[model samples]
Target: MKNVIFLIIFLFCLNSYSQEFKNITIIKSDKTEIKTLGTFVYEDDLIKGIKTKKNNLLISFQDVNKVFINKETYLVKNYKFKKYLFLKIINGNLSLYKDKKNYYLENNELGLKNIKKDEKRLQFVFKTGEVSLFINKCKAATNELYNKRKSLILSNLKKIINIYNTCDTSSKIQFADEVIKESNRPKEKVKFGLSFGLMKLKTDYNQPFSIEGSDKNFTFVGGKVYIFSNIFQEKLDANLSIDYFFRKNYQINDIDYYIKNSTQFTKLTIGANYTINNISKLITPYFGISGGLLLSSNSSVKLISKYLDLPSRHYTLSNELIYNINVGSYIYLLNQKIDLIFEYQPKINTKLSDSINLHNNSSSFSSLSFKLSYIF
Candidate 1:
């Protein structure tokens, strides 16, 4: 089959690309000549952190400068990170180096990094980010690589490094604008899910206004979508959410009301939630504020009094701005692909609306709400 042949070729390519650094020759950073350390094999335990004792020879990867294995060479350079092994592939005034995940360029004055093609594809921000590093020591070389092909591929990068190593001017590292912008920008994390909760509402819905029979105590099930991002700081995240709630009440009795009346309203809220992050990897506790602007509301009110019986009438309410305080946590599961979110909002001022042509122009209310959401 064609599938079997393709899989065989893929496995063969992977095996052919496997690198082995069995032997090591330690050279000091100060250009001192040391006796050759010939026999460091796979049995000696390579990559044992910074320091490792092997065959009575204590080798500290951080302290050493150059480590040569046969014809291949690895240079230890701590430009941005702590000392790590960088295999020097091309050597000169400008040299090309490669590690397990990234490729780097280093010269007398600067060391630049270019993330491997598959290392980072769609990430917006990270601790150490992907970048298209450039050197302007030679204008001709820079133009040829950047303008002619306009790519950040590995082959073009090698040409630029080779040409710049032979340049007559001073070499300095400069990151392109696109690389710098992407390094610091945090992309929005969007989540869509369903939320079901209850709201302990303090409203004037004594009896005259109760949509779906909910008076002071109400329950709501809604579809919520949230956009979360760590905008400014690592400890805080700025988030936005839109919720369409279906609020209803059940089990009505005559003993709780002064008059036989009920009122109900439907509303959609667009709100922001600012939360703390990284309390724990699995259970991240967050406490923040939720604020929103209500576009409008549709309310139906019915009053059945012994003296006066009134039919249910619909009222359209205007817009209002309100803010509430909440505390919550994000529970991550399945390698953080699924988030189980829980939020609790204490009693806060809930402005019903601007005008509804009702008994009151705009009534101020308070609500205690609890919502649980599952984000996939």
Candidate 2:
């Protein structure tokens, strides 16, 4: 119902603003004068006005004083002056005479005027003479200009009315109402949270060692350490960890002798980790590759083989491979800034120069590493 009412009001406004032009008609002042004027032109026709030498009394359609015509002499007049216009219809020759001016209009189109030296007006006596007071040609010119102007106005009005009638007033009203409602609504403030924390790591590992003997022989022991991280930021991260020992023991087999050794060693490594998935908000599985130099100190061997007759001494191993590949998931305990993590990074490749062999020497050494990490 509201939409129908809106459309009706819109169409009504369109029709009311359409344009209208006045119809003009000319009427001669006197009946006798109309007969003498030959009745060639209607009184209501449009007329072109011409400026003359006289200021107050000029010649135009609606304002001519008198008209006179004879066989050879035709005359036109205003209030203060008169002009002579001579034409021979058969020969097509016209001659005009005023105060000091003379002009000829023959077969060519022409008109005449009486010049007043001081006044800025003239008596325009046209070729048709007396009735030149009513300039038919000038009237036609005026009608043409009038019609042109009317046509332009009519076209513009038609366009305006069409656009106005076709407008969607209901949509415009709805839009305005929405704008007002939004302007009256209140705005809310936003808040943000921030936090940070640190992580730690621990690991257990076994390694083989050698002691000086009458014959060359090797022994092995199991050792474990806890690693702690300095910093961690996800996506791209860097951390340094220290290995603290939990167990140290060495055992040898097939040597026909015995030697005691302490497998105690401290390892320091700088590693980078990349995390992939986080499940249940508690476990995050990450796979990362890292390579850096490692140093081990406090390594000692006791001769476990008496038949080999070996002595005990301290040996150092520096610049070992720290490349450990692992697939592991971390559990978040504190779950805020810290993650409790367990990872297994196995030595998939080898370090060529560090491997020792008596009969045949292989170029690589392999090992497995397990670490518990506290992620920040």
Candidate 3:
């Protein structure tokens, strides 16, 4: 009897470990369908799926109607056209989705409650008071839902918690895994980050013939792409980032006359960061610096209505180098996984130009950016 039991257990373990993901096809509408490639399993009141190939997961949308396939095996589920697909998770951790709207199952039944693009988050509850429904990947039905339905979600969640006396152990754990598998966000979380709403620069001297203060405009758009990892399971953290910026501007300075010019360039940089006392389940502050080469190319300038009307504009293609630094903090929003970020960058570099001393000089530029981020 012992030998037989051991053999049965081993086989079950082997089968679960060897589990292969099948593709899921959802008919969202007459014009749309969703294709998912992941490992899927069914349990009472729960559907668990994971994409080991991509390291992604999805849970919640507990109700499934059919499993079918065309040329390939697909786990097909049915949903109503305009009801919110609430993923009720009991207790589990998984990957986060960047756009909750995109994490939706294809069937019309399992969709965001609203059709508005700007709205993207809903709260769900599973175990009355013991466990609550939280979104790893957030999607809003519309801005209206965020503004109007906030109270309804809170009320419903609270009421559900008041009724259930015990946690649904099996469903809760299973749903959490499902949430992770169905997520569409990046697999890794970014740290010590920065994003620019807008960065502007300017420089000018007097025109040759007139005192028209030559005005120039330098606008930059860029952000840091990096990864952050926790150390000692808590107190310490690390951040690695890549910084790049694209700059372009136009200027008309002097009141006496007009001197117009525009230029465009691209810059790249890489850096790493370290944080202390970071694992406290609260806000953590961090600092870091990065240095890299800046590659810039200049676009021709036009001297229209000023000097020569023949070839009114002059164009030059050139490149340059630069250095960068950053300091920032991470604030928790929904929990440890969701965050709001703010950072500052002060850069020093030789201006991009084509052998013109008038355009060649070294200066420091400064900027501040705010970003909202979520981690899985």
Candidate 4:
């Protein structure tokens, strides 16, 4: 009776252990499927199969059609001359898959030994009808390649989705093929734009020579033109710009003396801009910073020593450095090739030097600009 009880307990333990292993179904290339009880282990292009009461099996990825393990299905995919095991998340005409790829890096140590390390990265796979698209989720690569290709990937995905939604079963294959063809084509790397806008400038001078009363502030009208290039990515831009300001006049009065001045400021700037939002959309916002040379030309100040009784003294202001910070937006039209831009530059500061003494003086200003640009 005790022996019978032991045998029953042993059989029950065996049954429980078998239940712990998942059921895996492997579909072969010849339209045959095999059911195996094992724990599936995947390493690159091979799946290690540890079967019950059988020798371990090593299955080549190319010979396998699909794998069902742990109640989940994985499809074998080929991309960029590499094989990927994709976990199918959505099963329909258009499917989404989670993909994993293993990468090996070689390190040389002591000039004689080579060490190899493996890294696994996760990526996304989209299957539209019969077309497959791969999206990389790793940011380890340089921004140049990633930025240039990111928009292409998004555009292809959008096209694929649209085609899948509109096409019927008979025409789906043709549309999928078109999408694949378009996706495989090389995309544009560089985009160029030109901007022209109006600007307003207000100058504030500091301390020792602080103007009194209404003369403390001076406002001027200006116009600026800039040529900008999209570099590295769509969200970043490199710009070269020039600005011309109209003449502004001011009058200063002290108890014993009066002074009159007229000034015109011009600037040549080189800078960069970073867009905070979607660059491919109809409207995108950006912020920029620039540093340049400011030329204060036709600037003459006349000082009457005593109420027009003494001869007036004339002095000219010298050129100085101009630093600017601006916030702006781009409204895209004509398929994003043309844009209308509106920008508000709140802080533009420069230091004007005295031509005779080379003494530095501060000038602070602000401007609003409107420009039309073309992207190529």
Top lDDT prediction, candidate number: 1
The TM-score that candidate 2 achieves is: 0.31
Task: Using TM-score as the measure, name the better of candidate 1 and candidate 2.
Answer: 1
- State the lDDT of candidate 4 residue by residue for 1-376, as single tens digits: 9999999999999998777567778787797988876654555433433344246654556777788876888776664454545666544444445444321111121111111111131333222212222111112111222333323233444444344334343322122333345466444344455544454444444343455434233333333333443343356666666656667687777766566768776767777777888766687878888777778756756555776665445566667665667666766676665544454555555544555555555455555555565555
Model 1: lDDT to the true structure = 0.53
Candidate topping TM-score: 4
What tens-digit string does per-residue lDDT give for candidate 3 at 1-376? 9999999999999877665655555444343545676554444322433333355666333343233334532233333432222232211232111122223212122232222222344444122211222321222211222233334344443333233323232232223333334354344555444444333443323223243332233434454455644333333344433334444545564433343555555556665554544656576765656555545454434344443433333334444444345554565666554434444445443442325334433323344544344444
Q: Write down the TM-score for model 1.
A: 0.39
Best-to-worst TM-score order: 4, 1, 3, 2
Per-model CA lDDT versus the true structure? 0.53, 0.35, 0.40, 0.52
Q: Per-residue lDDT for 1-376 in model 1, tens only?
A: 9999999999998765433213456777777644443333221222322222235454555557777767887777675555666778788877777765456666665565544454354532211222233355566565555443434456666676677667776546544443446567677666776666666655444333442333376666666666766464334555555544454433333332222323344335555544455767777776676666544354322233323353323333445566656677777777653333444333323233323344433334556777777675
Clashes of 3: 41
Q: How are the candidates ranked when ordered by lDDT, highest leading?
A: 1, 4, 3, 2
Which runs of model 2 end up more than 4 angstroms from their true locations? Answer: 1-234, 308-319, 334-367
**TM per prediction:** 0.39, 0.31, 0.34, 0.47
Shift in Å, residue 139, candidate 2: 68
Q: Kindly report the root-mean-square deviation of model 2 from the true structure over all alpha carbons.
A: 33.1
lDDT of 2 by residue, 156-180 (tens): 3223223323443232212223334
> Between the candidate structures 2 and 3, which one is better when assessed by TM-score?
3
